[model samples]
Target: MSDIRDEMLRTLDRIVEANLTIAEREKADGNGPSAKLWAALTEQGMTALGETDSEIPFADAMALVARSGYHAVPVPLAETIMARRLLSRADIALPEGSITLAARAGGQANLVGVAYGGTAAHVVVADGDSLHLLQVTNAVVHNAYNQAGEPRDTIDLGKAKTIDRKPLAHATDVLIAEGALLRSVQLAGALSRTLEHCLTWVNDRVQFGKPIARFQAIQHAMAIMASEAAAARAAADMAVEASEKQADWFAVAVAKSRAGEAAGKTAAAAHAAFGAMGFTREHPLHYSTRRLWAWRDDFGSEVIWQSKIGQHMAAKGGENLWATLTEMN
Candidate 1:
């Protein structure tokens, strides 16, 4: 099983590296989700990983998602997978194209900062113990973009009609947990890519007849970036493992908080190492770094998750703190 998973991830990495070009990133800047990308992902069975008969593990699915982030692939791939999985849990038939999840309020749902919301065919909202499916056609959408230039729409369900409504198998907070986990995985991938780019640039760029990478100051900066990236990867790995074992909120919280903290530091270090070139639109480094900035705040920020962890610890008291920290997925 591990062999199969590794093979799949390697394949995905190649596919993303080959297809996710500068042109594709520019195309996605103001556009909705790409049909071509969706077709390719669906053909690879990447979109149906969470379906009942898909046979793909949750951890493997997240690994693919993280790879997508590494290449800075412009799509709502993560949201679509998460929406499909949640819909299945609620016994709702999954729709074609992109799908996103949201929370409903008072016969209406105002889903803010929804990735790929503008292009999604349907929206799944959990209201109390019921899950409601709403068509995108009926909703008023205010299209927006995040720091990464990815679509982050505000969907107004004030006048929308429900396509379907059914009893929910789990709480809506489950979506938040899963969303945070996904973002953490993506942040890790992007940070890794950012570090890679910085390393390459530093090694190639020379000053005073020597490579910048040879300088102690530059090497120190790269080391810090690498450390943050490593920490993020560890957090993402733990989160995915925990999710696969069963939804462990504590592990999820720790993963997001840790990864979120790493994301900011990694971005800052990458920029510092790369210098002015990293900030330019012509440079591809911004694609990874900007996404890192936007994603850290999505689902839940570091502050939010840190508070949750602190509250949980306080409730558990001091003696059990070590056990809680040492507990494995």
Candidate 2:
């Protein structure tokens, strides 16, 4: 697989992350990824991270996705990966350039949401039973942005001219689950990065000629944040393993729930450590914290996925619930 820098936090340190995610880049005019960076990524085959029915394993693809989140790399990478995988599964032609996936509900008239909405050249729309491939030029796009300065475009499919459409049963639901899984992993990533920033801040910020990390309360908060971040990362890895069979919602629900819950905790803990500095417009910490705040609510929020898990378990009854819990293993 063509890899992202080093698959480590320092990977983006090589690239100016602040430049990549500048708010100016997330504009209504349509903010595509930096052409130079895109070219480099494409040349390295990073754009093909999960293509070919994802001949690339989920673990590998998700690791890159997580890394992208860590740096708040503002591109439609995860969506592109899922979009390509969806197209390949239906034997459809894959379009060149960035491709994003958007799910249309049973009767929804327009493509409601997807990161990189107007920035992508193509889209794969899944509506429970089928997949429709579309060229962006064939549709009207209203550019918008998420809290993290990522593109969140709304596609006017009512006026779109489709390139191809094919029936792919349950694809819409699968995409939703997989999207949730992707976001969950991203949340975990940002949380980890946030904790790192917090740790550095507490260990370096001095008061009374002593680092704040020497204080008991700072140490306690750091421990809690570290644990939450670790749990979220563990959950992300577990979901990837479970979904090796398919885009299973059962696995995704657990991952999303844990990561979503951790997102808020980790962000709060991180900001608390940095105090006012973390919220400053120029601070790189906001990149990860803001993303953590937004991504937890994407795909499906903690409440939504947790409710789904509860409903499923309720229907399954006590004995079957235990079986289902261990089903992935």
Q: Mind giving the per-residue lDDT tens digits that candidate 1 earns over 20-68?
A: 6778768877676656677777788777666534578777778888887
Which RMSD values do the candidates have, in order?
Answer: 2.0, 2.9
Q: Which regions of candidate 2 are displaced past 4 Å?
A: 1-32, 52-55
Task: Evaluate model 1: give its TM-score.
Answer: 0.93
Error of 2 at 168 (Å): 1.1
Q: What would you estimate as the lDDT of candidate 1?
A: 0.80
Model 1: which ten-residue window has the lowest total lDDT? Answer: 101-110
Query: Lowest summed-lDDT stretch of 10 residues in model 2?
Result: 21-30
Evaluate residue 37 in candidate 2 and report its C-alpha lDDT on the 0 to 100 scale.
Answer: 57
Write model 2 residue lDDT over 1-329, tens digit each, in one string: 34532442344444435346455334321355566556555665668766545565767777877877776666677788778877887878888889888788766766765678676888888877998998766465676767776777778887766889998889788878878988998888788788888888998999888999999999999999989989999888899878764677888899999999999988888888888888887777987888888899887899999999999888879889777877677
